[model samples]
Target: MRASVKRRTKTQQDVQPETADVAEDVSDRIRATLAKAISEGALKPGSKILEDAIADHFGVSRTVVRGALGILEHDHLLERKRNRGSFVAAPSIEQAKELFEARRTMERLILELALGRASDADCDRLNAIIDREDAIHHGTDEKAKAELSGEFHIELARISGNGVLTELLEKVVARLALVMTLYEHEHHDDCGTDHHRAILDAVREKDLKRALHLMDEHLADVEGRVRLTQDHGDRHTFEAMLASFSPQ
Candidate 1:
């Protein structure tokens, strides 16, 4: 009788379902999928994400979709208007500047901390990521490479062993990816392989100052390459007609 009671108790404990916990997991899965799509450029900037459509596609209720989208909106990956539906965010010029500025500041501090705390195992993991990146780089799809590029910066914060810092850097990198998707004229590789390799070498050598300097230059070089003045206007018949009146 005692053994049977113990067995029954264990079984009940194992089978128990936390309804709230399950709902949260569903929402998290939805948010991660959508965020990946946006970061990979599969979902274009300013694209509308209809809750009904998402709910249908994911086989979830509208409530679940809403919860997921709320997280994305908080992360600045989506914007929810009062009357209008949620749309993928398109960072404006000023927002782009602020994003990059914040990224540089946060990432520099992260690297400084990582320099102090990263163990041999942590550094090895970073190297492995770069190796995977190299394999992806040689592949045909630039979009995959682009996603990895944003991840590299976030990965550094993870190596720092600071959860709060990692979360902050993750959001910063996501916004930066959106900025690049909107404003970059041509999509090249996200980060220069040589640049990444050099930074890793510095970290391994325990040259914190050199690592920091390289990171600063690498970021500045990337930002300088972006022409913030590039027009993002849609092609229209009116513009085409007006262009025909040019003196040329």
Candidate 2:
């Protein structure tokens, strides 16, 4: 009986790590899918994040969904209310201004670094990123296209060869998605590649002054779209938000 008990205990121990690993992996998938949906405007700001809905959709436990939601909360992508639940973050107008201010400050340094360090090939890669996003059909690949709206700046940051800067800017842009979704008026798309192309054009010509001016203006334009307060005209159900979500 002692030998049998030892064997059973060892089997359970061996299975525990594998079970934990699978749960963590599923949590990551759940997190990534929801993040992209949020960034793409499929998941509107201030929508309650239903842990049960997500768990049911992903065929995972509420524990796993909470793990994902916790990471999003850390990033300010989700806000947890006392006894209520998590909801998508809806930044106030003041918070929106601060976010843009920080973005302007960071992007200036990024453009400066990019101008000094970016190679001709880096310019081409930037062009490719822009073109690829442009090619996506508005109806067919709308999800991918919208999610990629802010990627041009990220690509440039990568060219600057500063991993830390790139990572920080990514977080900032993700949070900005919340701002844009909550505050912008209907029919306003801020990340139009027109601004991206113009900025890259200046960078390629090594015109740092022009590049900085254009980037500042671009950031300004996006910030200008925010109203102090507005009805959330596009909020969707939790079931709808998870409907198109696929594991990534």
Candidate 3:
């Protein structure tokens, strides 16, 4: 009878749905926090991820933190090791080049399609996004500017009216933002203004060829701005982690 009671207690403990739900909740929160950090450039590339520190910071169990880390690993934000703990992702120079090349190809295609398909309303919306980006750029908040700059491209993709291409562009833009944050040496002053204006003007003019050409130039400029040196040091992860503490 004693053995049966113990077995039943163990089974009940193992089958607790509430415990699983709570664990999932913690995992989501941790993942969001880390993702925000990466987006903000606080947790830079190659930074070490200490699970215990995150668990302590969030007041959650290490199990929950591990789950979150696993998700981030899948997202290519965090990397794991056999014995050592997880670390933030650091994109190589070759990877960064490949990412930009992909963006250039994909963005040109998007613009080529959008040149004729995008309505006046779509142009207006794109203009509005650029305005917001300008405000964010001039504001004292650098992180907000960074986020808005990335968002501007995503907004353009949405206006292109192709769901499949938009999704692909979203992922590409996210990776580009990560690369820019990790590898850029100097910030571009006209990051959001000139290229967007050119693209919008070409779209408004309904000149598909000109629009595509302008997009190529815009992407080339952006690619050129990134300083991709072969430094495999662990600074990226640390910087990304620090970026999460901003007011955003």
Query: Compared with the true structure, what per-residue lDDT tens digits does model 2 show for residues 56-144?
Result: 99888998999899999998899999999998887776787788888999999999999999899999999998777667633466566
**TM-scores across all candidates?**
0.83, 0.84, 0.77
Residue 90 CA error for candidate 1 (Å)? Answer: 0.7
Candidate with maximal TM-score? 2
* Per-model RMSD to reference: 6.9, 4.9, 5.4
Q: Please give the CA lDDT of all the candidate structures.
A: 0.79, 0.82, 0.76
Which runs of model 2 end up more than 4 angstroms from their true locations? Answer: 1-6, 137-141, 229-248
Cα error, residue 45 of model 3, in Å, equals: 0.7
Question: Please, what are the lDDT tens digits per residue for candidate 1 over residues 1-248?
Answer: 99999999988776666656677888988999898888877776767788898898878789989999998999999999888989888787789899889988987898898888888888888888888788888888776675685666777888888899898888878777778766765556636667778888888888999999999998987777555753742222234335545777
Off by over 4 Å in 1: 1-17, 233-248
